[model samples]
Target: MGSIEQPEPTVKIPIIDVSGYLAGDPKATAACAAELREACENQGFLQVIGHSVSEATQKKFLDAISRFFALPTEEKEKLSQSNSPCYRGYEKIGGQKLDELDTNATTDQKEGFSIRPERPLGKFLAGPNQWPEESVVPGFKEAYMEYFWAVHSLSKAMFQLMALSLGLDRTYFDAFAADPDGICLCRAHHYPPTPPDAAGRTRGVGAHTDFGALTLLLQDTVGGLEVLHKRTGTWHSVLPVEGAYVCNIGDLMQRWTNNRYRSTMHRVISPLSHTDRYSCAFFNDGALDMMIEALPGCVPEGEKPAYEPLKVEKHIVERYVQSYGAGGTYIEQRA
Candidate 1:
């Protein structure tokens, strides 16, 4: 007799609500903090609800970016990132290889536009952004800039919760996140549908760890995000949840927690069907020059930290060099 087939195991990424905590309820804050600790230790990825970014704002942001990407190829290439000293502009598909280890294999198959709100020249990556001419796309800059601040506000609150999760005071990360010049980097990525033949051979983005403190991602319904399960050792799809932002820790956070929290490896694969995928990632890296090391609260009673201490800028720039090569070089001379 043939054996009965086993049922597929259910896989779910944890989702947390912060509305109550955001409202200043001490009990809710503690509960959210504990949940954050568990999620960080195990999955390293979660969806956040009650983040206070309204649906209208989210729609406007997406619409503005979608309009920009829909422009003619020549028009978009006018702002090619390769020409930017600050590395802030359009990047054509296959411009980056996120999985630096697989040199012989395919590079990432997505196009992107990166922006950092204009600010004083302070650090390597800090300066004005490369935006499309106002005449080309009316109100584009304003819409994107508005969304940047909205998402950034949410990131700050999440940092406080992350601090509390590690059994530290809520203000633990405030100093690192206090600088406006080093505030954040936002990227809008567009992944064209995967060709039928390239389905198994190419990835929209290669597997890699984020080289920052925190990342908040807003994705369209054409989900292609996947996370590697720590225990199962298999990749699972992170489906889109309406009105939610996918949140995850980054390398600096992992170092700060002495490996107590994870900086999980993740990647994106394009839809094999005709659907395109769009996502905007808001990365809050903390003050660029801030030193990153294991917090005393995170180190075990006698064990040494797993990673060596380093400055936030050093770690981030090294990762960029790996992915963008010479194109990632920081431009010192301002135009």
Candidate 2:
């Protein structure tokens, strides 16, 4: 039988107020910070409301996602997975990584477009991003380019919350994430309808933890996001809370905190209904060249850093290729 989503206190994910953060109010920001700490530690995930991005920006991004997905298969294939250097461009279902797959796994059922922006000063952190010429999807490039900056702005505020929640100066993560050459991708995804009652078969994006610092997901009205509760080890559907972006810790965050935090597993089950599923995820990451070491505040007395510091960019690439089947294929690989 198909399961209906229920509100479970078995896990308490926060729904933070970003009003103060947006208004530049210090005290309100502090309150939100404390709420964030509880959410991160207790649930490792949360819903964010009051983020400064206006409804129009949200709509434009959505329009871009919907437009890209609406294109005919023949057109999308022009910028096939094989054509891109750093694994950017249009990828059909089963093109990149599937769940539970190693370096090479059978392609899964899903299609997506990945965009990782170039730094302003003529430097590339991610493998080169391969974009289709504007002719392919009129204004796709223009809309996406603008969207990246706005998402970056939201992510920076998120990082500050993370820093404060961990008992550090607000700028603690600034140096690490600034101009990161990391795989900070804007992944626009679509999962077509699936068997309506295929009880517990599989999902559009099978169970997996993202390979970055934070993931800011903007989901359409037709929602299918679910998370694995760390405490009970049970699954729960995050009901589609309109105008609220879901934020969750990624694998790297858990490693950096030595498990004080968690990178919970999540997935998108293809909807049983016959509607196309559209969602945009801003996967915030740093430069692969930057090392991710344990934060001093997270390390307990006599407890050493759980994982050795590794370059954010390289570590993520290895995992991406290992997870999705696209590594070092997008852009020119940097040292």
Highest-TM-score candidate: 1
For each candidate, the alpha-carbon lDDT, in order, equals 0.82, 0.73
Task: Please report how far candidate 2 places residue 233 from its true position, in Å.
Answer: 0.9
| Model 1 clashing residue pairs (backbone) | none
lDDT measured at residue 269 in model 2 versus the true structure, 0 to 100: 64
lDDT string, candidate 2, 1-335, tens digits: 22434424334457888888768798988888898888878777898998867788778877877887888888888877577555667777876554552333234567888878754323333345666567766777777778777888888888888888888898887765556554578888888877667653336676678888888988888867778887787777777667778999888888778778888787776656778878888887776567778877778898787888877766775776565544223334434
For model 2, the local distance difference test gives 0.73
What overall lDDT, based on C-alpha atoms, would model 1 receive against the true structure?
Answer: 0.82
Q: List candidate 1 segments past 4 Å from native.
A: 1-10, 197-201, 326-335
